[model samples]
Target: MPATRRSSLAIAAALLAVAANTAPALAASAPAVPNAPMIPSGSAPHLVGPHGEILHSSSSNWSGYATTGAKFTSVSASWVQPTATCDGNDSYSSFWVGLDGDGSDSVEQTGTEVDCSEGSPLYSSWYEMYPAYPVNFNDAVRPGDHFTASVTAGDGGSFTLKLSDTTQGWSHTVKKTLSNAALASAEIIAEAPSDASGPLPLTNFGTVDFTGAKVNDKPLGSFNPDNITMATNGSTLATTSPITDSKDFSVSWKRSS
Candidate 1:
């Protein structure tokens, strides 16, 4: 649909947030089903973050799905962008995660229309999602310190990531898992696009196989698949929304707890 980004630190905060506010007993209760929602019917496919024992997904402001196929004891939504068609009605390739059983719950949850069209930037909007719980992370990272690829999804999909920082800006290593194969190995290559060069392709995370999986799993703006790192200099990291506009969408950086 559009460019969306989530970091390990951000996911950590979400899990920690959930742990801090949730009742111990409730958090411990075993999930009866996989929480991953079905594919959302958007201009394209998109991904939803994972929740404990559940996957979250939604399409527009009306329908949501839970896979119930794969269950986790404790989960934080996370995954790498896929390589597939990334243009009109093709930008979003797939999405997983659940919404409240009641349709239209996301609108109230985030206070914005679930439908997001390109060129439509929402300054600040809230999609109130009824996730099993909020997944927050711990506050342990500092500027300048970093690592490379910390693992996203390992099932059939896996990715290698990297982080870079400088007085000028920051960049995340880019690598991706092939449709049906885990990205055996990937190295981030910095190739910024100039006015002449078209959008730079994300650094190759390595290649495995892709027979039936969608070619472009993620759209261009929805994420920095180009492997461009974020700069924290001068610009305040927009961890929380600070303005009001016409968009409200949230992504989960998943990790199993």
Candidate 2:
């Protein structure tokens, strides 16, 4: 499938899910807002290798590494939440690890978010079974907090998503089921959050470093994942560094939108 269409479908599914769960009065009072759902922006072509592996790709909303061409049962990563620099314009960003949503519709993911709201940085954490609205965690998230997250698919479509903040001493584990999940991809990414309209402006997160990234109990680099850069309208918004030691990399922000 074309990259643009794949991304659009993901966002559309999330919107439908949100609409279904909203009450008429609430829906009328305010539009449903997504909590840092991943929405690839722009229409960059995916460069495929001779072995059907994605070599490199670009997205308007995502930057980092994603491994495809396999059924991913587990994915995990750790990072320190990057601080966001706020300005007059509102912007949003997230750091996450997940399975699927690269070549298929469903994504089982959990992560933290830093958003510029009214010129101030707001930090939060959440998990989402894509096509379903994200559920926010009430625990506080702060810049520089060390966070570890993982997602595992179990028998009969059961799935477990976990996120923890070592700095704050809080953790959450959620169990959900998605019988038709494709489990097609695994990713460790930094992203610009989206809403029904489209991707929101990316927050100026400076940089976030991810370590111990693994998929299926092996280092993420073992699969030679695609190196993804975030861009829009020919402008580079964020860049991903080469993975070091098969498990470490960083995504640096260059622009807000």
Candidate 3:
């Protein structure tokens, strides 16, 4: 059928408008915005491998020792929760000891969180099994408190997470159960937790010394673990402070972002 002159003119005009607006519409939607930091949540970060396995990247927000390929039944570490400066907005970080979640789907973990909420430094303790939300404990953790935390895996997906403040002679423990956990890697770490937007900025915890790090019945040195330094965009975010013995180590905060 032959098109009418008026109908042909309308179609041409519509096509021209569409082409003129396409690039502008795309440009409006494609710019990336900076993400603000928030409190920690959910599973830790990893880059998915081609084979569907999790792999570590230098840019990750974790600095610590991870033992891979070994089934970890238990992991533990001790550190003095450092007093953090809350000069910057939305600054946060966590010091923890955990099994799994370094490269797999599940984490049985517990530790202390140092976060700046509205310019005030806040301290607390919490535990989480991945795929489920984390829970904060009622126990008070002050700056410079000596903390010892441990996580142990048990039969039928049961697990135990314990946190002790040896400086204050206070301790809290919880037992919970999870399903289909991989039990892949064990870690003792200082982490900038993930938020709805991705990795949150680590708080200025100054220097955190980790002592008595152990997995199963062996010290961290016995496993030939990876000493991780968290970085991003060619800048260092955190670093392993030092160790007189592998059983004891530290992570020093470099920059918040």
What is the TM-score of each predicted model, taking all chains together?
A: 0.18, 0.85, 0.76
Q: What value does the lDDT take at residue 56 in candidate 1?
A: 24
Global lDDT of each candidate: 0.20, 0.79, 0.68
Highest TM-score among the candidates is held by which one? 2
Model 1: per-residue lDDT, tens digit, 110-219? Answer: 11111111211111111112222212121222212221212233345433323222221433433344343312211111111111111211112111111111101321
Q: Pick out the ten consecutive residues of candidate 2 with the lowest summed lDDT.
A: 24-33
TM-score of 1: 0.18
Cα lDDT of model 3 by residue, 107-211, tens digit: 678888776644556576787775565666755677888889999999999999998989878888899998788888888888876544456677899989889
Ranking by TM-score: 2, 3, 1
RMSD of 2: 6.6
Q: Which stretches of candidate 3 lie over 4 Å from their true place?
A: 1-57, 241-243
**What tens-digit string does per-residue lDDT give for candidate 2 at 121-155?**
66778888877767778676778889999999999
Ranking by lDDT: 2, 3, 1
Pick by TM-score: 2 or 3, better one: 2
TM-score of 3: 0.76
